[model samples]
Target: MPSLGLKGADLMCAAPTSLTLVMTDMRLSFPSDEELLSAIRGHHIGDQPLCGFAREFGILHEQLLETAAAHAEIARRRDELAVEVDTWVAARLPVPHPNASLHTETVGRLLDRIAEAQVHAYRLLMTISPDDPRVHAAWYRLAELVDGYTDLTREVIQRARRLPALGDRR
Candidate 1:
């Protein structure tokens, strides 16, 4: 059976040291970003002892927070863009023989714009510090929006295909 590698032979094979040695080594390793922030913010480590490191880490953390906020703003703008495109699509799609060429061209342009916006957002999100939970959540939301927009564009393509003269002209 597959093991969790936390006990007995698995643990021994992974690290041929006693559990106490493993625990001691783990404790000596540098703390994670969250742990560092908690230590500095909570004063778990004496201020005088870690003042320089804390200040530097604080600045980096603040920068990451600002980046996360910017990502959120970009996401909001993308949402607005999506709404605008949806409105334009709705207005034009209902008209009979609404310049099929123009309609298809507009839809393609909108999809391209959405794709570019998503790419920019993803790049910005990737620059954010990985340890920040907000970054992960924002990336996930952006991914969902990208997926939804893609699905919507596929539906638009289907609608365009159903146009009696569209495939014939193409």
Candidate 2:
């Protein structure tokens, strides 16, 4: 009866037999990628070469970088479109007069801006998870704005269309 020197309360009494079983079970378990690499490199559990693990890690790291870059580009596009829409909306808001002609121009411009914003937002939504409620809300708002602008533009265009030509038609 050799003392295995396993010191841990009740387990210490059953140490020798339990330790053997545990070691056997652990040896039978599947080795991790690192372990496999170490084995391949002629190193057991101690100091191992791990060249294979290094290669695999490198490949995964590169893929992660590529994914990050793509996501960044998408974010950049969304930001650019948002800024453009904001600028267009701001411009349309403060025009000197609320006349039919001005209204028509403003609405037309706003509609165009809304259309662009919708496209960008849609692209972003496609990339993001559908469960994101904020994106859905923003999309709805964009749609409403586009519709409103379009309706306004149509009314103005109709009114302006009915008016006689501005130039002297003598």
Candidate 3:
């Protein structure tokens, strides 16, 4: 009778100079085509496959192209959103004094604060549902921050404009 303890064969290929021992613990796994395709799909970015082998299968061409197109569409949408956000911010914020570094720095800090508030609002929205009361509150807080920054920036720019040049006589 065959030994019941033996689940698989211990493969060994011997050479004159060296010997390689293969065991069950060191078994190699070749994933199925479906599994490979699925993995490739899951991790692909910006129209490029994470794994080079994703292009090996002929059947995967159409699927890969479709996935790449989807990624490209997502990228395009993100770019559009970025442009919209910049335009929105520019519309709301006061322009800093051209020759005043202090005015620019003050405005820069206010912008940073606004960006932080926006990030907080975004995170809250992501964590909670759109209809949640907290989501609305977060958005309100972000708007208030921006409004406050706008008021403060206007004051700073006005103050900077009123300051006379250092070498000028009164």
Which pairs, if any, clash in model 1? none
Model 2 per-residue lDDT tens digits across residues 64-129:
335656655544443443344334333323222345453323321342344444544555587788
The lDDT of each candidate is 0.36, 0.36, 0.36
Which candidate number would show the highest TM-score if scored against the true structure?
2
Where does candidate 2 clash, by residue pair? Answer: none
The clash count for each model shown is 0, 0, 0
* Model 3 stretches with alpha carbons more than 4 Å out: 1-108, 160-170
Q: Cα lDDT for residue 58, model 2?
A: 28
Higher-ranked by TM-score: 2 or 3: 2
Candidate 1's TM-score reads 0.27
Q: In angstroms, how far off is 54's CA in candidate 3?
A: 39
Single out the weakest 10-residue window by summed lDDT for candidate 2: 12-21
Pairs of residues at least 3 apart in sequence or in different chains that clash in candidate 3: none
Q: After superposition, how far is residue 31 of candidate 2 from its true place, in Å?
A: 65
User: How many residue pairs clash in model 1?
Assistant: 0
